[model samples]
Target: MSLVLAGTVAGLVLGDAWLWVAVEWSPPAYAGFYASGGFDTPTTVALLVAAPVKAALLWLILRAPAPGPLDRRARALRRLLYLAVAHALVLWYPIALLPDVVGAVFQLALWSAIDVLYLLVIRWRSRMLRAAAGVAFAVELAGTADEVLDELDLPELGSSEVAAAVLMLGGAAAIIITLVGQRRDGRWSRGTQAAGWLSVGVYALVIPFGVFFEGIPGGGPVLPVVMGVMALVGTVWLAATARELPVEDRPADPPPARRRVTRVAVAAVAMLPVIALIHPEQTPHLTHTGWSPACYDRPGFGDLKPAERDAAFLCRARSTDGGVPPMFPDGLSDQEVLAYGRVLCRAKDHDEQEAVLTRAGSARAAWGADPWDLVYVCPEIVGAAHPELLRSAAETEAANDAHIAEMNAECRDPWPRTKGVVQATARYFLFADGDHGYLVHDPGDESAEGEMDQAIDELYDDGDALVGAVGSTVLVGHVEDVTDLCLTVKAFRTAPPRRLAGWDQVTEVPVVSRSGRLTVPELDGGDAGAGAPMPNLAIAGKGRYRLRVHVRVGDAGEEHLVVVFPGASRKRLELKS
Candidate 1:
């Protein structure tokens, strides 16, 4: 009953471990197989079934007649097998539970060794079976070490490929030598015969697939599937042969439990070096949060492209000055960081944008939140540029109300007035950063304007229009990168809200702006000296209005909102009325 209870507990522990692996490490398609609730019914049922099955098998084996006194060689092999099983089982725990294929192959070999060794302990003499299992054990041990070295990104110990080749060649030679010279028991159980054939068959199948079809370290499912089949077959064979042990006279009284424990402890000490070699946690490119290619050796970003380098520069400056990344703890992926760089590069002042990012980062840190969480959701980083941090909520609100009133009267109002001064602001837009790039129409001809436009246009598809209209200047440049870029425009009353929407409106401009830029073609084809400016999106009422232009470049579309302010025109037109 004690042995039965121990088997039951072992079964439960193993089943729970398997369940944990399935839930946390399985591929997305397979995760759901065992990831239901706290009390997983399938896992529970499997564990319970295994408990009684294993318990019964143990009871039968214990009840069987004991073996006659072993010869010197047999006793040595028994001790060696015990050591191998103990050390290999520890290594196999994490490796078998890993969801990847490289692990599965190692796990199959370790499991096979354990099974064959256990059978030998019970005196099921099969020399051919022992030889095949021994060969598999050697190959898997070398293969697992090779794989672990590569996964850890450690310096190679010779070539893993060469090592695997030599190990496999030796195993093949051992199998041939055993088959020619060794012998099996005259009367083998059907299960034992089947298990032996299956073992050889699996060993033959794994080598070629692992070498030619699938490269070592990582790949498709051939090896994993073969290993899985091997495990299933080995388990079935173990169960079938559990009752086929040879009858023997009762042996001398069993050794004391304390003596047995001491022997086991001595074996473990002898195999410490073997156990120390299997370190899976040291594998590279993995972190507590998750695997991110973006996090790999990206310190200086020397490997990045030119634009990504600029992003890296900006990130470095921000971190140096503000003690935080503009993005976050891990930073953005290559393209995203570049896009953000383009946005910052286009700003009228680099110092201002850096200051804004710094303040934002500081605020996020104060709140114990990620910098990216603040930046992605923050509104202050929008438009030609963000303004100074509002000192007070009331002051922010008052400024917002005044700006809205001015915009409504000059840009949103519908009226005819005397020609007012046409102010021209040379705003620049960049598109190189993919989806994260924004269109800006600021008031100034900064030195970085052309560069910013070039980068932004790089993001545009060929034949796409580069529409820029600020104050009275509207010039459309064609996207020369590819021929699929085009423009779409719309009007709206309110700007789109960002992820963090509850921020004070007075501190930041709305995403939509009527006076920022224009993409609407002018009616009557009027040229504004240099080129055709987009038609003046003139508002004819004393209210707020927004013109949203959507530029479709390839599969993605970018939206630019310019809130048109008529300025003094609305008052002059009202006076005329």
Candidate 2:
């Protein structure tokens, strides 16, 4: 028994040391789901409780007289082991109360299973005690019902978090108190004392640090292998020790039955908790489960393993459905639209991505008009991975040109003669960041250049120039060739299609000037590398104004439309298509 405790102590110490090595070698990549780790909170709470309980059991066992009959020492050890398990059940109770009903059944079935095992070992006495414990636990917690409710309503905490925290704490305290009451000692061993304390001390430090900090470095794979091994070893150790003790000299239970039954019962007792939590939604922290996966597979997806469903549901996907990034439901900002483009860039489901883009572009338009997002989505994906289902950039641009040439054949309204409005054009190589200019209220700010610098990763990863943000500025993307661009300015009385087709995008942005006037930068395609930012043309006084920039693409060039209004938000509205 003492030797078994020593192995546990050694395992705990070595595991923590390995953890330090892993963290130094390969720290967490805090970008993925779960802040990029597994179910961090519940697992941490479990470890905090389990460590001290196991330590107390080891101490109770060591205090017993060496390898003797079923005495006071043996009974005390058994009761402490029971307390460790009941504490685990207490931990599961709140976690099981998640969003679905499957979790609830799993929880109750698990409690029933544990009761079966408890009765076979400790007889009828354990059940009576368990029922009494349950009653007392409820009564004790009833006093703080209002506090729990208040905590749940807080913005930082919710039903899942608050309930788990409160119940887990109560469970831990109950476990410790129950173990303390069964304290049996003549203080038989100092070496055993060292081993038990060492296990408790190391576990308390390592588990919490691993959870709340940068996360276990190689913890993704390393943790499960180490924990699984420890569990197997502990089960074997306890089972072997239990064989030596005589719980009773009753007639119905023979020697052979006691030997085989006792060992098997001990093993099942250790494993019942593991069996209870097999649902994909409630990820098993002690075992290997994909808490967050990279690729999402819809019903029509060719071949893939099941990822955590909660993650997919968050992306608005389900078992038979496809998903989009969490955007589009609310009014979008320029940054949000830019961020959505980035998600589309990395999407594996090319067909689904294209469908989402095309559908959003075309069908959502009210009357007969063009899509505002016609300039977006595909170009963004092209810059990233070149989505499989979409056409090549050359083909798409050629189609856009032919589409515009057809639209230009229709009679259109003349450009509006309005103040606070001017048109400027430039030659930009689409794939290259050559000489593409932007619309800004402050010509002197140069923050647009800083904004360009901020998009270095996008540029490096996908050769993209289209996505960026700076204060009071809206940037443009690169084109395939240095195409001839014609600028056009307009002011809309009401939101409607200024033209029937050929419009790629029309979105809003703020333009402010305290000096009562500012210069709009001219794009002359000179030696400045990116359209030569030498100030030139028109100026306008502004007070609180927003620019609704319109981009209409054609074979000849792109006609940019900037419609000045009194608001600032990046909303890609539908034109009557």
Candidate 3:
């Protein structure tokens, strides 16, 4: 009865956690940004996927169990425990992947050894599954807090000395509640907990190797799916524990372990959070090393193992002579050579670095705006030299400036003075990070993906456009029909309300005005920069400006309210009477 009760409680808490994430935790703004913009990050994906799995398992548990319910419940509860640990491992494993195949194996081997040794030497196992689960939960919500805070820009919450991530401890709280409640039921013996942790740890060690080397079913996001499956089964197992059964069927607890080792287990489990918190920034590394490429020698990374500390940081490595790297087309890969060049570019002496800068400048003149070339790579190495790279083509810059001035004078400012409409393709539009995703995605280009579906059913989902904006530039979506898209423009001195009444969706982006005139081009047109000239909005002086795009749809066509502010884009554009 106690086991059933505990299992029932565990089922409820797990369901609740899923409910909390799906409903209360995920903000509309942040979640929508990710969903529509196609920014499916790992943590975001895990949180979304785990919630549904837990919910489904909760449903499965609610149904009547087959004969021998007690045994089924016990097995299910054990899987549930493993599932919890799997969620925790999702965050830790990504850090390990960047390290070479051998480094990953070694880390897992050491962990497995310690896990085995705990049982052999101390006669018991220590598990930090819950603590790790907590850290993973915190990390997931932290991204949400960051995104929301970025949008809201609250002074008190945003300006605080404490990291905004700390505020997103709701996930940690949910896991803690589930673990604490499970402890209330004595049926959750130390042996049962140990077994569950062991199973999950093995999965963590084994899965990454297959993902990194052997290849998983999905090309990407295999970890989240793997963790979600473990958790799914685990939840179902817990729910089964609530089944009606005899008390005599309950599993027996193992004998108590050595007294001294209890502290060891607790202390060791406590350190897992420390290890989980240190997220290292990525360094450019074409080759796999003994440690994660990102695990450079930073002071606070004391939590990192010794192997990681010893490996030279990929970015700062120098040649044999400690001078500039070997000339282009050396033994090193282009990326490695670039890293060395960047090292020389950052050097203090201009006279010493002048040769490289001059060469990069000449390359810029020859390449002329082709991306990923020498001109593009050098700027990140020395940002101040960005203009210097461009200045090599003085005649070109002058011609471009003259062209801009000519275009600005020929501004297509049409609205209050003359009434007309702009043409739009259809309903669903998207504002995304990459320009090529929705526009001009070359059919032959293998690298271009995650955009474009020609099927008409994709356009008819709900009739409303599923447009989103992660950044200002690219907008793409499905629309079955093309129609006249009209716009009502207003200019404000101050930043206006982000959304307006009756608009389906609204977003704002900062746009630069070099000629005091900015154009609103076809964001969701056929080919990029291929159609007719777009109308321009003129401002008084040069600087930064904001474009607040308010979109709404009707049976006839889609309507847009473009509000322009010096920054807010809120001021009313009072026409000259």
Candidate 4:
């Protein structure tokens, strides 16, 4: 019990620590997904509850009275144990939202099948736990596969259907094997044993899978691999100890309750209150108020007096327009809009001002069409103090244009500025930049020379290369080329050359030196001399951005992308070249 408690605490702490470390070490390409927070109080609650509940369930099963004629108690206890382990694991797991409710449903279905199999065929509780844990590993593999498919631009293949199908096939195969084994011998068949061993192998395989596909889940490699290692260890322990350490003899009487079982039961009972004490009722944090421009026509606004209606209009307009980046008509200047805004601000009664503005709008709408956004009598708000209110309509239009431009220049829209990915068209290139920049090679415009520098620079630091707040460590120069070379963009893996939206473009760019046409396309085409930066290298930000072109090393099958940081010593510089 003491060992279990200590290990549980250690596991929790280590899991949390590793989560943070993974977040820290994750590549820039995958960092966007993790920019939001991770495991919350719910995960902690789940973890705290899982172990005790499992122990309690196990104790109950151990204490159940034996069956009179048939092994009914054993069968019942097997079912209970299966339910316990499966529920515990499911509760402990933090499900991702992308797959939504389907993920949970699939998890339930897959784990339940494993549970049923253990209940029907497997006699040893150890094998049952191991098999259930193996299913968990399989689920992780399915999840990783989905992520990999998404990255590869095969989104259709990455759907929940694929994951569910894979899990179902695996589950069905295991079940069929178990059934076949049951027919061969009442004790258990070779097929069942084979399946159990195969499960162990599958569970063990996840550690390597996590290592290889660390960048796939955006959750980093450490956590998944650690989880796999733990699962494998548990599986092995259970399998080895099952026969030697059977819980009790399957006899007519209930087994004597051992001190360990009693202790486990007491601990489980105690955990309920602790869980209740620590349980959190999550209250959503309201970030902003939702207001719409078209709310005036809704139920509440009807039947108001003209003055009140104007006030309502003003309220709605101000709620939507205030604090937002000012964008007046083309002719309006920022100074003029500010001046008008200041005039509007002078009105002591907002409702009265709204009424006046409404009337003005009505008159304009009746006589000639006026833009809804154009505050027609804006200057008139201060007509008593300033004679400029009597200015010609043409002057007002010009002022409005000037106001808009000036406001836009001064006030940056937070959404665009803070967004992780800035999707924009530059020449024919569909360029998106966050922590790293990605350039889709749409070469409608032959000279992409100076077009992408600003977008590229925004993602990376000036001079030597330091990635921006929302930039990938490795900037993808071009995704569409012959090789499906995987490059690390900071902590994430980005492979390219798949189809994207918009015009088709040439993958390779012609290179020109002091001498005309230095290298022919085919003769020196493949990742040779540093031609126009293809999506061929990891970004090395040394004060400036440098592309580390990966070249084949000797005649070996394996290849490594050279690490090039600009302004480094000759060794690094030569590597960059």
Score each candidate by Cα lDDT: 0.37, 0.38, 0.39, 0.35
Clashing pairs in 3: 76-237, 79-234, 80-234, 429-467, 430-475, 491-571, 492-571, 495-568, 564-569, 565-569
**Model 4 TM-score, all chains together:** 0.22
How does model 1 fare in lDDT?
Answer: 0.37
Order the candidate numbers by lDDT, best to worst.
3, 2, 1, 4
Better candidate by lDDT, 1 or 2: 2
**Model 1 agreement with the true structure over 1-577: per-residue lDDT tens digits:** 3654564465456654443333222333332333433335544554444445444433433333234465554454444443443333234455556755666455445545544544355432556666565665556455555555666676644465576567665544443333222224322243333444444444555554443334222333323433443443333333333333332332233457745664554455335435534446533211211132222333322234544434333343234234433333333333443344445444455465555445444333332322222232222443113332312345555675564344323321111131222222111223433332333332232422464455445334433334433333333343333211222222323343321222111111112223443333321222111111333333333323332232222233221223343233211111010
The candidate, 1 or 4, that scores higher on TM-score is 1
Candidate 1, RMSD to the unseen true structure: 24.3
TM-score of every model?
A: 0.27, 0.23, 0.27, 0.22
Candidate 3 lDDT tens digits, 1-577: 2333344345345653332234223223433332443324564445545555455544554555335433443444434434433333343444445544443343334333322322222211224544444454445345444444454444334344255435444333433433343344343444334323433333344434443334222334335344444544433433333332222233564445642354445444445445544445453333422233242333222233445322323322221134434233223443555554564555566454545434543222222221112333354543355443333345445665564445334323223342223221222223333232132112232422342333123323435433322212223332323323444455655665444456566655444454555444443334333123344443445555665566556663555556555663433221210
Which candidate should be chosen as best, given lDDT against the real structure?
Answer: 3
Q: What is every candidate's alpha-carbon RMSD to the true fold?
A: 24.3, 22.5, 22.3, 23.8
lDDT of 1 at 4: 48
Candidate 1 lands at a TM-score of: 0.27
